[model samples]
Target: MAEIISDLRQDDVEDTVPGGIAADRLRSIIERIEKLEEERKARGDDISQVFAEAKGAGFDVKAIKQLLRIRKQTTEEVEQLENLVDLYRHALGM
Candidate 1:
């Protein structure tokens, strides 16, 4: 299995030009993307931890998340959404 993997890597090297600049650039781009993805995952975990702490503190996590979503929206957008919700509620006698 090790020999097969080595052979495959050798074939890949052979396919690239002698200078391998393109291959090196591609590798660098891929490594940077992987690093960013890892960082994003860590940040997500931190966010989840904060949410857990909020829940433990007796805050409603769902409402907090909803507020965060609303905070990201513009005032005009929120008013439009609220109007739509009110219209729909009235339609349904809610």
Candidate 2:
């Protein structure tokens, strides 16, 4: 992969576009980006399927997503946020 990228870069320098950037190089870069975007979409579909399976198993998808977000934060950050929520709830009498 590294060799392929290096070769592409080498060929790119020889075929400059109007603004000094090689047209081939620009095309290569765009193609690589497009391929990655397609892969990302496929991965997103896979994740959605997993979420559907979890829902079918009786899990609450919304709460699961919230838990996923909470797990991304530090424990101290979560505690601080929860404390703030509790304080706000108390003030609101809810």
Which digits, one per residue and each the tens of the lDDT, describe model 1 over residues 1-88?
Answer: 4453354454466555554434654577789999999999999999999999999999999999999999999999999999999999
Question: Lowest summed lDDT over 10 consecutive residues: which window, candidate 2?
Answer: 1-10
TM-score of every candidate:
0.78, 0.83
Instruction: State the C-alpha lDDT per candidate.
Output: 0.82, 0.87
Query: Candidate 1 — which residues are off by over 4 angstroms?
Result: 1-21
Tens digit per residue, CA lDDT, model 2, 1-94: 4455455556576797665566776687899999999999999999999999999999999999999999999999999999999999999999
Clashing pairs for predicted structure model 1, backbone only:
none
